[model samples]
Target: MKAWLILLGAMGACAMLTLAYQAGEGVAEHRCEVARAVAKDAARSEAERRDGESAAGTAQLHDNLGTQLPAMEAEAHAATERIRTIYVEAPVSGVCTRPDGVQAELDAARARANAAAARGL
Candidate 1:
C-alpha cells in the first residue's frame, strides 16, 4: 500500500512539472512575437523618414532649377546676339587674306587643337 502511494505521488509531481514547462514555453513564444512586431514597426518608420527626406531634396533641386534656368537662358541669348553683331559689322573683302589678329587667333586655336589631340582628347 505504501509503494502504491509513493508511485502515485511521483506521477502527480511529473504532471505538474509538464504543465509548468508548457506554460513557460507559451509565454516565451508570445514575448518573441511581440518583439518581432516592434522591430518591424521601427524599420517601417525609419524607411518612411528616409523617403520623406529624399522627396524634400528632390523638390528643392527642382525649385532651384526653375529659378536659375531663365537667367541662364537670357545670358546665352545675349552671347549669341553679340556674336551675330560682330559678324554683321565686319566688312566684306574680295581678298582671301585674313587680318593679322585673325591669323594669330587661328594659330592659337590650331595649337590648342594639336595639344588636345596629343592628349587624346
Candidate 2:
C-alpha cells in the first residue's frame, strides 16, 4: 500500500510540473506573437512617415524620396529578411529591435516609390 501511494504521488508531481512547463511555453509564444505584431506596426508607421516626407516641398526631399529612399529601403529590407531567416533556424528564433527599424525603413521606401509612381515620375 505504501509503495502504491509513493508511485501515485510521484506521478501527480510530474503531471503538475509538466503543466507548469507548458504554461510557461504558452506565455513565451504569446510574447513572440506580440513582438511580431509590434514590429509590423512600426514598419507601417515608418512607411507612412516616408510617404509624408516625399510630399515635402524641397528638392533634396524629392530626390531622397525618388532615389536614395528606395536603395536604403532595399538594404533595410534585406537586413530584416536575413535576421528573420537566421531566427527561423530552430533553436534561437526571433526578430529583435534592430530588424524592426530596418523593416520599417524598407516599408517607407515602398511607400515613397508608390507615391512617385502616382506623380508620373
Candidate 3:
C-alpha cells in the first residue's frame, strides 16, 4: 500500500508539470501574436502619414503653378525686349578701332554677366 501511494503521487506530479508547460507555451504564443499585430498597426499608420503629406505637397505645387506661370512668362518677355533694345542702341554702327579703355569696359561687362548668372536669371 505504501508503494502504491508513492507511485500515484509521482504520477500526479508528472501530470501537473505537463499542464504547466502547456500553459506557458500558450502564454508565449499569445504574446508573440499581440506583438505582431502591434507592429502591423504601426506600419499602417506610418504609410498613411506619408501618403497624406504627399497629397498635400502635390496640391501646393498645383496652386503655385496656377499663380506663377503668367508672372514667369511676363518676366521672360521683358528680358527679351531689354535685349533687343540693347542691340539697337549699341554705340558703333560699323566696325571700329579698339578703344583705349575697351579692356576695362569688357571686364565690367563680364562681371555683370557673372553676377546675373549667379542670380539664376
lDDT of each: 0.88, 0.82, 0.88
Q: For residues 33-94, write the lDDT of model 2, one tens digit per residue.
A: 99999999999999999987776657677776898888989999999889856643332435
TM-score: model 1 vs. ground truth? 0.55
Provide the clash count, candidate 2: 0
- Per-candidate TM-scores read 0.55, 0.45, 0.55
For model 2, the run of ten residues with the poorest summed lDDT: 88-97
Best by TM-score: 1
- Per residue, candidate 3 scores C-alpha lDDT tens digits across 1-121 of 9999999999999999999999999999999999999999999999999999999999999999999989999999999888856653354546644567875787688789889999999
Off by over 4 Å in 1: 69-121
lDDT winner between candidates 1 and 2: 1
Error of 1 at 113 (Å): 16
- Local lDDT at 114 for model 2: 80
**Better-scoring candidate (TM-score), 2 or 3:** 3
The parts of candidate 2 lying over 4 Å away from their true place are 57-121
State the lDDT at 64 in candidate 2. 68
